[model samples]
Target: MKKKTVKQSLAVLMVSFMAMTPFQQTAHGKSTVEINADAAILVEADTGKIVYSEHEDKALGIASMTKMMTEYLVLEAIEKGKITWDQTYKVSDKVYQLANAPGLSNVPLRADEEYTVRELYDAMVIKSGNGAAIALSEVVAGSEGEFVKMMNAKAKELGFEHYQFVNSSGLSNYDMLGMYPEGTDVNDENVVSAEDMATLAYYLIHDYPEVLETSSLTSKVFRPGTSEELVMKNTNGLLKGKSYHYKGADGLKTGTTPFAGSTFTGTAKRNGIRYITVILDAKDKYGQPSSAERFIQARELLNYGFDEFKTVTYDLDSIEKKKKHTLPVPNGKEQEVTIKVDKPLSIRLTDEEKDKVKTTLNLDEEKVNEDGSLQAPIEKGEKIGELVIDTNEKEEYIFDRKSSDYKVDVYAAESVKKASWIVRSARGIQDFFVNLF
Candidate 1:
């Protein structure tokens, strides 16, 4: 009986060890890093394809990384002519108080001191200054509270359905999800999910590259009036030196909190390849040096994408570029007449598969109305038929395997007589009504 018990214990230990070994290989061979964080994600910025992910959709406190949205809004303000770099804002008492408040990052601007929007932005991003964040929020939205509403609204606008906001500065003392009583409906600031961070990062880079320039700065001088001449250093150590040896790793935000752990939205560009990596709640047992872990993961993801996946440009120049035609009906008068694409066009494919993919025309009979006959004369480039590609493969991948059939719209060459004017007008009205809903 004792031997049986010992054998069972040994078996359990072996199973556990076996389970851990694969994860170890994943960490080592794949160059993936595991942190104490709640979630992390790595994506190829060019393709928008996720390369690595773990609990990516799980929401958690985003900490100061909320400033990414802050940066976006500020840029929007600038673009709308509501503000400019040269515009100077008087330092308010609220801004002064927040600046001097204990435990908050600040440049400690005097109430009388003024800074340009550009300077304030530099302070906000370079120092991760809570006071700077609040001041910018107020200057943009009249108050931190109003600015937070903008933040939440922007999250919704960006399709970040998994997020909510309660403060301009992510300094709330409660879980963003309100899991505790301290996490009241208001006053409890929060955000969650590394996927949202990745989404935000993508927009900031693709939609607003100007904001990316600020995060890449390692240090900056805020004001020259001070005795020491206010110098600020970037909180994101990954941007510090060439020692990390990551090319195009520049411009992003980082965050940390007791409840949130560590969070970051980092972007790197190499050659034409760009990638964004978001890590949330990253920490070690001793609670230091997690940045290196994230860097390793990001480097690995970028290398894998660039090395493993080759971008193939299917030379469409060889295929006869056909012309599209318009039908000569009422509104369908010969706008254009075009031939079908007889080949599957692709950007990424091996030499062999690229040769065999052939395009075929699919001209299905027009859909009949209540009378069981075709609708009125078709217009040029109208959706009359389709072009299908045949790859000769049983299974098809969207990009390389086979191109899905596309509708062919060859317009009628003849125009309707004047007697059909009333019918065409009725059809136009019907179309307008149908689209109104």
Candidate 2:
């Protein structure tokens, strides 16, 4: 072949570089997202699929959003019979002083008066009442310190990698007027990653959806029809009748502090889909946005989720291929057993991801023999493996405790009892002869 001129070679190289760029970027590029915060994320509630994220890894002050953990523990205690909604608590000196402390968000409480668990919880969730949270922590754990320990444990069990708890109320230690939980610094504040906060919100709503019944209320009378009647409006401005109300807006929490700046964990459902969004350190070109500005940031994120992505569902039968496959079963009445997902699989995705998603079967290794065959006596409907959904996009998930794969467990389609002894011996002899050959 004749050598090409320098200019001709350069032209070919440029064309080749352009041709390779698209494929390289498709393989290696991260999907970039923009949100009005230091860290933010949007995830589908049911599946925990990360639709978009921006600097979601840093652990920062969460302000009153820390109450979600307290809320979870309270609900769990109620569910476990450790506490009752009507159970009453006398306001301790620390909690009473904190409740009446100037500038703190709280429902007015007098030291002499007793309150019910139900009323305190209402104040905490609906109004982001700091002292109410402290009182409830005392009710659930016998002390605020013990409740903090429970919060940390629950966070770990929920798959949180970055989080810290100094108090049940999420107020900075200094804000607690020397009443912060024992062994914590006066400057300490509850800190958590955006992803972790979203995870907390996910479990809160899923584990006890009844929370929304109160969280969704735009305003409630703290002690309606009584002398202490005071209407408490939800801090989550995105709720209906609030400053930045968005359609489908409901339960969740909002927060602000000098350290956390502004943060919000917001959830809303529409068209049979719900999205959980987290905004940490809400900001803009002008700098730290107002406390309520976090809702605006959340609205933008929820809008992107509700608009850009769509839910795609696939029942086992609807899968075009490989919906069911047979696995070998040795010494059984049947030679093989068919397996499939127990129910439909659903995931949220953008148009691009929808086209790129693929399905795969993963057999449980523990149940398979060395030769990849199952032993006889397989039970019908036994969990055998998982039906996983894969996609090319870089994805984050809230349920890291579960496998990264969005999957449903597969089960055996039918029972396979052991074959007769004579039949097994004959099959073993046939297998020996076949292998020798």
Candidate 3:
């Protein structure tokens, strides 16, 4: 069974678009997206903002897209110095048989086939080659089962809360359930949600960008002397032609199974900005090009995000002008503090609307003594209170506590006496003498 290409299906209607502005910049940006998959999402690779989404939280069978996790784990191993690119891996009979086993997408390998770490990596990522994935997994761990344990461990370390892995190749056979005992079947395939997939894609590209080197290739060939060179072509059709014109459309991975449907995880970089889009269970409607529906939806969302919205940085100065005046403090005070506004508030709105963006300073209500300082020293970086922002009849939200670097010092008792006190005593004595007269 070979993985089939997802053809574009019915055109989906675009609705309820929200335009998010660059933080503290202008408010005219907009987001428009169209998608037909059971679940679709476009996220800012850096901010993890859902530029657009439909059924974004739904968990679905992602099919071979599970390979994305496999790739991530492999890259992580290389990064941690557990393995190297030039490392040699000997093919085992189990992995070799599984790699060559019937699958929709595979780079069949025979026993005794030896490949460098880099060559096998290319086959797995570039060719969507299941054989390559299993072979590499076996080499990294003593066996595929152990390699899968590593995969699950890596997923947990990466904070993937909504996913579980059962195999390295992601070939879960529902039809062949009777082949194994009821309790120990290989049918436990990897599963993930749309949000989880986006998160996975984000970490993969952000942390280990080198993985794309293989996923983005149009084709690849691996040769070890004495063995005929093996040739495999990339299954991702987007790289083969100039259809979307999306800049930086590099490699990621694609997956499909009868039960899981068509899935793709792709990364694109445009104008120094990068994004990862995942479409799970992509189905073809009538008259649509292969994967066209998904491609179109992904492109529109990425474009809207890149074109209309720009990242505007709101520095501490923006917060200072809003009102909280600093009381005099000891020297060496660090007045600087940063507040991260989750979303850009509209600055151009009506005064009433602007006023709605309220703030509450949670300063200590402790009184300052006559010594010109508070009775107790306020600890630096301590949360005295909070600054709350309320906008347009919405909930009153508390801003995070901001701290100053300097501590307050109290005036010494001796410093308040002597000449300064004598002058005060003389004035009191004069008033008393006048009253006696």
Candidate 4:
């Protein structure tokens, strides 16, 4: 019997388990911070990894946060060449009426006034202007009703099962549509889960990142340089030096209504890493300390995510370069071919669990020919083996060895061509002479 060394190649797959599982202990531990919201979630912008969650899948009224989707579609339309920023749209009677509605947040627009696409976008995102949002929807899709359909379709396409949008601005349906005709008890408010809202925030930033340019603005005037100048202040309290300002806080939306009670989808960037936080139904009624508890909860979640997790990059290129593994080739011009990992891997982990990370390589020896070599004519990217990684955590753990985690397929680095009979004979003679020396 012999003791195996770390550097030695093993004939069988290797499985190493640590005595103390850091991930399991961390998973079962209670959160240090309390979230006073009906539903809340925090996720990494790049990987979509959920760092902290509480009732994240509960569907609730999202108030003006619905405008995030409208903003996304408007930018998408511009990107697809369907519309332009400078294009002008005349306000309709319905849009005018909605803009001046008693309780809704809006930038007053006269039916006869014409506004550019850019002004409407700025008004909607910066001010949470419901009227501006509906007007923009009508301009893009011919009618607000048609635009709502588009929003729902896009939501479905994005893999959202717990969301429904009845309007572009997240306003209650009864308020926007004027009274249910008959025996209809369903309110026309947009309902979405915190998880889905987080997903939407991620996609909104991922696809049309330019929205942040306007969202980050503390204040701006609609119809600038014109007689009817309307100043629109951003509703997101976390931006700039606002009351609940968090470091690195930037563009995002805030929502509030009697029914929805202060929901927010906030994004921030620090040290090149971005995070999105969604808090729904955060109000003083829920034992929250203040009216601005949604923003406070969001900042707390962001702090937790940044402070607890660290991104780890598995430099597969360096790994492959260091471990020069090769496989013998039979009936070929070359005797062997080099192999390496197919792709690089990166994952987020806590400081404690980082030290437990371990990896193993297992080659499929059965693929080799009985003559102790691979059959020639090997392709450049032929998969010959696999690399398995373990962090001494259960499969259900957050950063376990899933498909999206630290796994890489080993492939042939170069192709191998078949050998000619004369070349094989010459190589044999050369090998014999070298051995004799």
Q: TM-score: which candidate is best?
A: 4
Candidate 3 or 1, higher lDDT: 1
For candidate 3, the TM-score is 0.65
Per-model TM against the reference: 0.65, 0.77, 0.65, 0.79
lDDT of 2 at 335: 86
What's the true lDDT of residue 27 in model 3? 18
Candidate 2 residue-wise lDDT, 1-437, digit = tens: 00111222212211111111111111113344445566778888987877776555667778999999999999999999999999999999989999999999999888968999999999999988988999999999988998999999998788786678889998989988888898687867788878888888899889999999989998889888899899998888898888898999887998888877778999999998999999887775466445765787788778887887777876455445565678899889998998766778877767777888777766788988878788888999999877778766665566643344578888999999989999999999999999999
Model 4 over residues 1-437: C-alpha lDDT tens digits?
01111321221111112211111112224346667667777778887766777655556778899999999899999999999999999988888889888878999888778989998888899988888998898889988778888988998787665666778888877786572212223465677778778888888888888888889999998877877788888878898768888879887889887667678999999988899999887745435323488888788888887888777766444345556678788567777998877566666677766787777666667667655568787889998777766656432211222443356788889999989988888888988999999
Tens digit per residue, CA lDDT, model 3, 1-437:
00122321212211111211111211122333445566666666755645555555555667677778778878878988988989988877665655665644666666886778887888778767776777777667766667777877876676554556666666664532232112334555556666678878888887997777767777767664536567777766457454654667885767776545667777787766677777766545542223555566566556666665554322222346654334322211222222223333222223334444444433345533343333223343343333443333321101111321112222111111113445546757987999999
Residue clash pairs of candidate 4: 173-188, 333-419
- The clash numbers for all candidates, in the given order, read 26, 0, 14, 2
lDDT for position 18 in model 2: 18
Top lDDT: which candidate number? Answer: 2
Candidate 1: lDDT of 247? 69
Is 1 or 4 the stronger prediction by TM-score? 4
lDDT of 2 at 46: 86
Ranking by lDDT: 2, 4, 1, 3
Please report, in order, the local distance difference test score of every candidate based on alpha carbons.
0.61, 0.80, 0.57, 0.75
For candidate 4, the 10 contiguous residues with the lowest summed lDDT are 11-20
